[model samples]
Target: MENNLKMKDMILTYIIIGIIALLGNWAGYHVSPIKALPGMLIIVLITIVGWGIKKILPINLPAVIYISLIALLITTKIFPGSEWIIKETGNVNFLALATPILAYAGLSFGKDLHEFKKLGWRIVVISFVVYTGTFVISTIMAELSFRFTGKF
Candidate 1:
């Protein structure tokens, strides 16, 4: 019963996330004619969805949503067209948006920083390896894709 409940909660969380993404895409498509409006709408819709899900759902989500909202506001209001924001905001946005979910994960996983200390070196080594591997693979793939399609 506990496992089933956990599975159900996981499914619900994914559904809500999907809804948020769809709404963002919809807002992006509809608001494209106006500069910044689509992005703004995407951010607004995501925040609303995040808040609504938290209110309605029984599961504890991560703090990414709150962080995402903050990042979005910063991007749209302060750094609207900065090259740094343009190039890196998407990645940062995911981290920010995922804050709530991450928080939940942290709580579910024990919420004690000291617990992670035991695995410190192993965790760091694995994370570094994964990050570097992903970066290299993605870069190579992106370059190849651009070369093949002449679009980038």
Candidate 2:
């Protein structure tokens, strides 16, 4: 019963996010909402499927893992109808979707300020270390890729 309620809430939330992304796509990218709706709906359907898969599977894993897997598989050349899916989804500007998603992430962080405060300075130090490591690794990878491809 609880799971069903959570599913409903999640679906509603996805729909709301899709609507907001559509608005953002129209306003920021000059794409008509009507034109983008199909792609938005396809994306939302994929997300719902991913969420459902997470719920059905017994293993403990993040929904994002499932969502990303689903998206990746459907868009790959090996997948049937991949071209159509890719073409339809291309109408939606990714940045438009990212803006609202990032805004919500920021809001979530703000809501967790108390929990964040309890971590004290350790979180800050860890954050810096993690960020620096990520930056260094990313730079190295980018340089290697460029050298290998003879693009630098």
Ten-residue segment with the worst summed lDDT in candidate 1?
Answer: 29-38
Candidate-wise lDDT, in order:
0.55, 0.91
Using TM-score as the measure, the top candidate is 2
**Tens digits of lDDT, candidate 1, 51-106:** 55555667766536654765565557466564445543232234433555665687
TM-scores, all models, native as reference:
0.33, 0.81
What TM-score does candidate 1 reach?
Answer: 0.33
Please report the TM-score between candidate 2 and the true structure.
0.81
All candidates: CA RMSD (Å): 13.5, 3.1
Positional deviation of residue 111's Cα in model 1 after best superposition, in angstroms = 5.2
Candidate 2 regions with alpha-carbon error over 4 angstroms = 1-5, 115-126, 145-152
